[model samples]
Target: MKITKLTKGISLKRPLEGGNEEQLQVVRQVLADVRAQGDAAVRAYTEKWDGFTLQELRVSTEEIEQGAKSLDPQLYADLKEAAHNIRFYHEQQKRSGYRVQLANGSWLGQRITPLDAVGLYVPGGTAAYPSSVLMNVIPALVAGVKRIVLTSPAGRDGQLPTGVLAAAHILGITEIYKIGGAQAIAALAYGTESIVPVDKITGPGNIFVALAKREVFGEVAIDMIAGPSEIAILADDTAFADEVAADLLSQAEHDALACAILVTTSERLAEEVAQEVEKQVAALPREKVARASIAHFGAIYIADTMADAVEAINSLAPEHLEIMTEQAEQVAEQIRHAGAIFVGRYSSEPVGDYFAGTNHVLPTNSTARFASGLNVDDFVKKTSMVYYSEQTWANHAPKIARLARMEGLEGHARAVESRGWRKGE
Candidate 1:
């Protein structure tokens, strides 16, 4: 990681994708086949890929009840606590439509409506993430979505992750399927004999799943086309160098492709954090993956001033941002964009990732400029409206007619004129 002169602006790195044209073509074929054959195609793919024979794609209430009961009592309690916090975090973002009446007597307002159903794709590769199940479903539930369907790949024994089942049970979501990957996305997008189609899809998965969602986006709404997880820390002399290094290493531990960087104005802090990073990287269980990520895309920059540091931070617009600096709040205010901001020394990025209540599912790859973190707003839609009283119409008919006619839209003008106010009758 080089601390070079901050002259050239940060260049965009193409975040890695699921696969090349060959793999995408396969995904397209699978989606097409599933769309054509429905349940049989899905089951066949399940057997061939996941190695589990799923006679019934839908998970039953008995299974969920047994799975939840089988979990260690403490684990169930924790998932419940996390679910409550996640629900509370998203609850604040819920919005409602309102009707407004003008002085003249016409009423108009915007209406907010929740989608009927959403398919949440929970990835089961490597390990199941019940946290993801909580993050994706709670928002839609808080938004009052009527139906929340979930799909995840099963193990060789054809079992859903116990933690995932426990979390869903806590959330009161009974609809889940033993499916995963692009195939599951396909089934949800196109509908099958067992898997019901949904209005929207949201979750994180491997490249194949990401690309599958990307391909199906037009047919069904998608939360985001996510890339690898990333985190950036901006620090000053007041910051704890070791803590910064640890936080960066946390995201790096996620995968070899994950990115973690530090940008600061303090040369001493930068060097110390660099050394701490080396010291900590060796001890991590995921050290190899962290090392590769750090070696490839990770960097530490020593900016000439805090403003320069801020400039670099905004340029990255990382998925998770930590401000561990003197006047951290001031730095936070200067930050123009980020998926989520961890404001002080005590608030590490992982806290939000797991327990701190804010959403860990967020826009990656400088998407913060135009995107937002996952919230209740993601699950709802708003439609705008307006109305005017008869008196109000008569009061402004001439101007309306003049503008309509001026635009060469006589029909629009006549529509107003036919009201009988234009001729003052």
Candidate 2:
């Protein structure tokens, strides 16, 4: 980790990886094939990419139960507990329709409706993420979404990971599919013979999956174009160098492109954390990935003051931010642009990632400037409703017609005036 002095106009933005033309072309072709050939194309792509012949696209209830049962009792219990925590938190975000009565005997309101169905893509080549199952599904369920479909690539043994199955089972999600990559995205966006199209899609995946989501965005709603994981720690001399280094590596090990940054007012702490990160990276299981991330994107910045450090963090707009200073909560209050804020040493980034009941699906890149983490709102639609009584329309028709005419829309003005009010009457 290299150390630098915080300066004005410094940006921590990583170059977003929009898939190259070759990848995009592949994704486009897959999407078209799936739309045309339906189940055949899905099966062909699953065999080519996942190396498994699909006996069935949808996983059977028996298989789901068996896979879930295969998990160790303790692990299954822990997953259920995590699911409970996530459900409890997202329950607060559930919404209901609202209407406001007006003085003119008319009403304006919003109708909240859950999407009919949603697709959740779980990545499944090298790792199993049961936590993602909980994070994505619980919010949609809380929002009263009835149909939820889950898709993941099967392993060489032609089976989904037991932990992933167990988590979905805990959530009572039985609509599971054994397919992945761009093809799975295509199947979700456009209905195949075996799969029904969904109103929205959510979750994280590789470059191909990301590109597929981008390609089919307007056809169906998508959660976000999530980038790699990131963590930016705002620490001072009061923070522990070892703990700070550990938190940074938690995100660094996620991908070679993952970013871990330390912004500190104490130069000594900066030096110690940089050294500590190097020492810790050596011991990680994903050391190669962590080393590459640290070498490329990780850094320690020495800020002249705490205010300068906070300003730098806001500019970065990190996916995950941790404050471990003398008054971590107070420092966190000044932050305005993080996807999720973890205050104090105890609130490490992974706590929110797993058991803290906060959704781990967060906006990446600098999108935290405008985007938000997944919640109940993402799975539902808010439709604005308006009702005008005849008397109310008569009272305001002239002004409405005048406003419409100001925009040079003769048809709009005529539509408002066609209610049979004579001129000057």
Candidate 3:
């Protein structure tokens, strides 16, 4: 890892991947075919990419039960407990409609309604992510979404991962499909012979899945165009170097594009962490991936002061931030931009990734400056409600009309005036 002095306007912003032309063309073609052929297109694509022929698009209830039963006893118990914790945390985010009446007998408010249906895409290429199932599904359930569908690629043996299926079963999700890639996204956005279309889609996948979501966004709402995973640690002299290196490598092992950064006030701590990272990464099973990430994207910055370090971190606006300074909590409170902040040595990044109640799906590629992690709000829609009494309209008609006319919208002005209120009436 390279060490540099912290400077103004420095950033670790990686460019968001928008698939290449060939990939985009392939995604567009798949979406079009899925829309035209429905289940046939999905089956064809699944067989081609996943190497499994699908006799049925939907997973049977019996299969779900069997898969859940097949999980190891301890793992099943852990999933149930994690599901409970996630549900408890998101339940606090549920919202209700509210209205406030004005003195003029008019009312204005907002109504919160859960989406009718939602699709969750769990990636199944290199690894199975049962934790993602717990993170994405629990919030939608808390938001009161009625119909939730899960889709993932099947293995060569024609079965989804037992852990993924077990996680879904624990959450009471019955509608699942053995489909993946751009075709699955298409089927979710547009109804097929067996699968019903959803109002919104969430979860992460490869570049093709991301491109498919982008193409179908107007047809159905999507969570975000997620980039590679990233973590930034802000540590001081009080922080332990070995522990810091472990936390940084946790994300580096995720992808070759994954970024790991450390900003510290102590140069000694920076050097120690770099050495520890090099020594520890050699032992990981995913050593090749982690080594590539650390070699290309990993770095340590030496800040003259703690304030400068925090400022630099704010500019980076990392997806996951760990503050391991003397006053970790105080330093975290000063942070203005981060998808999620883990304070102190005990709150490691993986805690939030797996067992912690906080949602792990977060903004990436510096988008935390404006975006947020997935939450209950993502599964619900807010509709503004306005009720104007005749007297209230009579009082404000002229002003409303005048404002409309100022924008050079004659039709809008006429529509407001057409409410039948005249001057001096």
Candidate 4:
């Protein structure tokens, strides 16, 4: 990792590539082919990308039961506990419709309802993310989404990892499919013979899946276009260097492009953390990946003051921010932009990622400046509703017609005039 002195009014560019047009065009062609040929197109692409020829696209209940039975008893118990915490947290975010009546008997409000069905695209094969199954599915379930379907690339064994299947089974989601990549997204957006189209798609995937989601957004709703995982730790002399190094490597090992940054007011602590990162990274199993990520995107920034550190952090708008200062909570309260904030040394980012009930599906690539992490609200839609009684219509009709006329929309004026109501006084 490179060490640098903080400069005012400077912006840093991300080293990772955003989806290029070539990738977009490939996703476009795949989506077009799937929309045209349905199941046949999906099958061909699945073979091309996943390298698994499928006689059946969907996983059966027997397979799910087998997966459940294959899991270690302790791990299975932990999964249930994680799911419980995740569901409990998201249930608090669930919303109900509300209406407000006016003095003239006009009612206006919003109706909140879950999508009929949703598709969860879990990264599979080498990426074993059973935690993601719990993270994505639990929120949809909490929001009352009835039909939750999951798609993942199968390994050479022609089945999803037993743990992934077990996680789905625990959530009562049986509609698992052995398809992945851009094609799975295409199939989810525009239905095939075997898979019914879903109203929304969620979860994380590779660049192909991200581009595919971008292509099919209008056809069906989708969660944010996820990027590489990242973390930023704001620390002082009070923070333990070893713990900070471990947390940084935890995100760095996620991918070759994942970013890990440390911003601190203590130059002494910055040097210590950098040395600790070097020592700890040497022992990691994914050393190559962590090294690549740290070399390319990681940095240690020395800020002149704590306020400067906070300002720099907000400018970066990192996916995860951990404040390990003496006054961690106070520093956290001052932060205006971050996907998720982890306060103090004890509150590590992985706790939110796996077991601490918060969703790990966060906005990346500085999207935390405006967007948010996934929650129960992502699974539902809000529709604005209005109703007017006869007296209310009579009171407002002429005003509506006059405004429509002012906008030179005669059709709109005529529609209001034809409601058989007296003109407003």
Candidate 5:
């Protein structure tokens, strides 16, 4: 990694989806086939892609309990603790229906209702992310969603990672499915004979899964068209170079395209962090992936001042931002964009990723400018409530009719006038 002098403007690298065209086409064909043929299509794709024929798609209670028990007791306890913390934090975000009275005696409010069912996609195979399981499921559980269905790829042995199952068992999520990739997304969006369609799907996956989500969006709601994971650390002289390097590398190791940036007021800190990154990355298990990411997307910008650094942070709108400065909270207050903000030097990025109770499934690839982290709100729907009093209707119908007439919608005007309302009457 190299430290560069900050110019008037700086932009993050945007990589193209070069060879993903074929994967995208595959996703579309699978989605269409699944929508048409249902379970047979889903099973066929599972066999073709995952390389395992499925006699049973759903994981049974016995499997979940056995997996949970098989885990090291200490890890199981840690998962239990993490789940409790996640539930507590999300419970604070739960909302209730509200009604507001108006001068005209009309009532207006919003009724918050949990979606009937939701599908959570957890990636399996070599990546056993039980933490992701907790992050995705806890919010839906807090929002009072009735049926939370989980799907992940099974191993060559036709089994989900025990760690994932342990987390699911801890959360009491029973409807687990042994499928993954674009096919699992299709099964969630459109019902199969074995797998029922869900109202919404939430989780993160590879490009194929992402493109699948994009295709099935209108058919069933999706969380977001997520890209690669990324993070931006806004540090000053008070920040530690080694810790900063480690935190940045944490996100960089996620994938080859994952981005890690550091914006700082001190050129010395920038240089030190860059050196520290090289030194630390050499010792990582996923050093090859991190090296490629750093060589491609990682950077250090020496901003003129903290204000300039904040401007760059906002411009980038990174998924995870760490404010490690003298006044971390004050700096965070000026941040108008970012999926999640980690305040203070003690609040490393991974704390929020795992045990800190904050969600790790966040917007990536600058999508944080308009999107947010997965939370209780994603699992629920808001239906606007409107009730017009007789006097209120009489008072406003003529105005409404005129507005409708201005738009040449006479049927709309007539509908408004049908209540014995006419202009100046």
Candidate 6:
């Protein structure tokens, strides 16, 4: 990992910023082909990418049930338990519509409702994330989404992951398909013969998936164009080196492009954390990916003061941040950015990733400034609804008419004037 004294007013460009773009154009082409040919195009792309020649795009009910039965009983139990907890958490976020009456008898408020059908694209093949099934489905289920479909690439065995199927059983998710990449996204956006079009799509995937989501924004609502996982730690002299190293490695293990950085005022702590990372990383099973991530993207920036450290962290706006300073709580208050904040050594970034009752899907690539981590709010929609009585119409009709005429909108003025009320003195 690179070690340098943290500099104020200096910005470090992310290495992923200069990544390959030829692949992006290919993904766009795949999306366009799928959009034009529908399922036929998707089937060809699936064979090209996942090496699967599917007889059917949609998975069978028996296959899902058999998948559940194939998994370890204990893991199946755990998946159900996790689903319960996630559903309970999201249920609390379910919003209801309310009517607010004005003094003139006008009523207006927001009506919160769920999307009719949604698709969750889980990363498949090399990486099968059943945890993601729980994370994405629970919120939609709680939001009253009736039909939640799932799509993932089929394995070489010509079947989906058992764990993924078990998660579906726990959540009662019926609709699923053996499809992936940009083509799958296009099929979901513009429905095929077998696959139904969904109101929205959520979950994470590779660069191709992100670009496809960006392209299909108007056709179907997407969650976010998620980037690689990243973690940034701001620690002072009081921080524990071991804990800091573990937190950094947690993110680094996600992929070779994943970034983990440390910004601190204490030179001694920075050196200690670097050494600890080296020792700890060797023990991880994904040591190769972690080491590559640390070597290429990881860094320790030693700031002269705490304020400088805080400023640098804010500018970076990492997906996950940990403050292990003496005033970790105080530092948290100064922080105006970051997808999620972990205070003190015990509240490490990984805690929020699993079993911490917080959604781990976070914004990356300096997007924390405007975007937010995945939450129950992502699954629901709010529509502003209004009702007006005759007295209320009388109360505000003239003002509405004047404003409409001032704007040269006779139709708008007549709509108000057609209320059949006399103009008062």
TM-scores of all predicted structures: 0.94, 0.98, 0.97, 0.97, 0.96, 0.93
lDDT of 6 at 260: 93
Per-residue lDDT tens digits of candidate 1, residues 172-253? 9999999998899999999988777998999998888988999999999999988888999988899988898999899988
What is the overall TM-score of model 3 with all chains considered together? Answer: 0.97
C-alpha positional error of residue 58 in candidate 1 after TM-score superposition, expressed in Å:
1.0
Clash-forming residue pairs, model 1? 18-207
lDDT-based ranking, best first?
A: 2, 3, 4, 5, 1, 6
List per-prediction Cα lDDT, in the order shown.
0.87, 0.93, 0.92, 0.90, 0.90, 0.85
Lowest summed-lDDT stretch of 10 residues in model 4? 9-18
Separately for all candidates shown, the number of backbone clashes (residues 3 or more apart, or on different chains) is 1, 0, 0, 0, 0, 0
- lDDT, candidate 5, 212-319, per-residue tens: 988888999999877888889999999999999999999999999998999999888898999999999999999999998898989999999889889999999998
Q: Candidate 1 at 175: error in angstroms?
A: 0.3
Residue-by-residue lDDT tens digits, candidate 3, 1-425: 88888887787645357779999999999999999999999999988988878998888999999999999999999999988888889999888999999867899999999999999999985578999899899999999999999998888888888999999999999999999999999999998999989999999999999999999999999999998899999999999999999999999999998999999999999999989998999999999999989888899999999989999999999999999989788999999999999999999999999887999999988889999999999999999999999889889888999999999998998887787746544
Candidate 2, pairs of clashing residues: none
- Give me candidate 5's TM-score against the actual structure: 0.96
Clashing pairs in 4: none
- Model 4 RMSD to the real structure? 1.7
lDDT of 2 by residue, 201-257 (tens): 999999999999999999999999998999999998899999999999999999999
Error of 5 at 58 (Å): 0.6
Error of 2 at 197 (Å): 0.3
**Residue 268's lDDT in candidate 6:** 87
Weakest 10 consecutive residues of candidate 3 by summed lDDT: 8-17
lDDT of 4 by residue, 318-392 (tens): 899999999899999999989999998789999999898999999888989999999989988999998988788
